[model samples]
Target: MFTGIVEELGTVEAVEPLADGGRLTISGPVVTADARHGDSIAVNGVCLTVVEVGEGRFTVDVVSETLRRSSLKGVAPGEKVNLERAMALGDRLGGHIVQGHVDGTAVLRATEPDGLTRFEIPERLSRYLVEKGSITVDGVSLTVVEAGDREFSVALIPTTKQLTTLGVRQPGDEVNIEVDVLAKHLERLARPQLDGLARGE
Candidate 1:
């Protein structure tokens, strides 16, 4: 339900370890202004439910599975994270339809002076990308400029450079990535027919 639009750069205050998961406390003035228990917030592209909210701070739990999958695995006390609340019913979709569900992680390969950044993606994920397609990286939605077998590029304007975590990210850093849901859906829908065609049916 998120738009992949980062509302603010939240700071991780604490991380409490648990048997099955970890509790994260983060401070985000914009997102916590009207936060409530059970509210969903996108933290670095992962949709997490709010366990508590107060004094410009909020808490969320990340299970072991999420830790193993996304770049949020080793988030530290002072790490800056992208934060965005779930979109309201009537709000405009400033970005694409972002579920705040991280599919996997991509390593930042390079960034140009003009903010043209490229990430080295896995072939499994790259298959879903197309020129000008939408992709969410660390919770910020961006359009693909050059789609390759195992890499892609996106232009981040000055605004995005100053607002989101991507601005400060350097080459070699890892980031959570979510491919367009629509593309994944289409592939699934066509899989059966495509399989039949391969069989000469």
Candidate 2:
């Protein structure tokens, strides 16, 4: 699990193809300071297990399922990525509970800028969003400032823009999206009741 708070902006050092998966060597000095083999780290909201650790880099194996669900499939060396260590017990929930399990990917439809500020929302994942609801985009926690049937917007402060990948996002870019877990649970719980009402039962 994670808090959706980005700890560092790491880079992909290398990528090697494996038979059923692939090995990624990512450079993250802070997250690997005390890291060891078999530790889990959240990369761009995707939980990855550490296979080896060096000076400031670590290796992780990406299975086919993860590749299909995230934007990591075509990731190349030198690409910047968000990094966060798994949430420890008793830690303050700075952001919402992020599973690092991406629900899907969204396409950047547009960016509205003001004062070097911007709001970048996905056209595909807008339905799950609501005003003031929590969202994880590229592993950074943000709130929806506005929403629509096919698009939602988030106001990005300068710090967030500089520290994470959202600062560089452009129209037509793909981003990993993890919807609020609580909202999903509530929807599941209400589904049957709503169905019964529709049936006049």
Candidate 3:
């Protein structure tokens, strides 16, 4: 698991195609300082395993499923990506609990000079979002300012605008989004009751 707090802005060094998936070589000095194979790292909110570590860089294999679910499908060399090491036990949860599991991708709809940004999300994911709820976007945890049927907005601070990939993201860009895990759990736990109510029982 992760805290959605970005530790570094890493660069994609290379991408090698594989039969069933692909391999990515990313240069993230901080995350790889003590990294070893099988470690979990959140790269742009996707929990990818370390395949190998070498000289301030590491390799990860992205399967077809991850590519289909995230914005990493067509990631290229030299692109910047948010990087975070997996949180250790008893560590402070600076941000919300992020599983690094991208529920889906959201599109950057618009942006304002003051960091009030809007994103158009998949309609099905809207139910989990609420005002003030936590959402992970491209590995950065942010609070939802407004929620809509197909869109939502968040207020980004100056530090966020200069530290993560969201800072340089332009309109029309697609980014990974993870709705709060707690919300999903609650919904699952209440589904049976909700179904009974729907039947007027």
Candidate 4:
């Protein structure tokens, strides 16, 4: 339910380990201004629920599953993270539809600097990328300029360079990626029924 527009770069204040999960306290002025308990906030593309809130900071519990799926498991104090609150019912959809659910992580393979920067995509998420398709990297929505079997590329303009985390990422860093939901649904609908064919009985 996020627009994939990063409101601000938040910093992790603290991290506490639980038995099967962990609690994270992040400080973001813009997103925490009106925050309340149970509110949803997208932290680096992961939609996490606020368990507690105070001046410019909020707490969220990162369960074992989320940790396994995202780079948040490696997050530590002082790390800068992209932050966005859920889009309001009547708010403008500045970016494409973003669920704030990280499907998987992609490694930064390479970067090419032109008028618009192009990032060499990762193999795991390349199949979902296409020319002009929408992909969320580290919580920022971007369009693919070219795609290949192992790597794809996206054009990043100056504005995108200054506002989001993708601007400063290096090769080898991990980025959270959420493919277009419509593509996923279409793929599911088009999948052949192998089980039915195998069981002719």
Candidate 2 per-residue lDDT, tens place, 105-197, comes to 877766665432233445555657898898888898888877677666778888888999888888778888898888788888999998999
TM-score of candidate 3 against the unseen true structure? 0.98
| Model 4 lDDT tens row, 1-201 | 998889999999999999998999999989999988999999999999999999999999999999999989999999999999998899999889999889888777777655444444556667777789888888888777777876667777777778888778887888888889888887677556645566763
RMSD of each: 0.9, 2.1, 0.8, 2.7
Residue pairs with backbone atoms closer than 3 Å in model 2 (clashes): none
* lDDT by residue (tens digit), candidate 1, 1-201: 999889999999999998998999999999999999999999999999999999999999999899888988889999999999999999999999999889999999998776579999999999999999999999999999999999999999889989999889988999999999999999999999999999999
Worst 10 residues of 2 by lDDT: 113-122
> So what's the TM-score on candidate 2?
0.92
Q: Per-residue lDDT for 1-201 in model 3, tens only? A: 999999999999999998888999999999999999999999999999999998999999999899999999979999999999999999999999999999999999899677689999998998899999999999999999999999999999988878899999999999999999999999999999999999998
Off by over 4 Å in 3: none
Candidate 2 residue 151 C-alpha distance from true site, Å: 1.0
Question: Against the hidden true structure, what lDDT does model 2 obtain?
Answer: 0.86
What global local distance difference test value does model 1 have?
Answer: 0.95
196 in model 4: Cα distance from truth in Å? 9.4
Clashes of 2: 0
Tell me the lDDT of candidate 3.
Answer: 0.95
* Candidate 4, number of clashes: 0
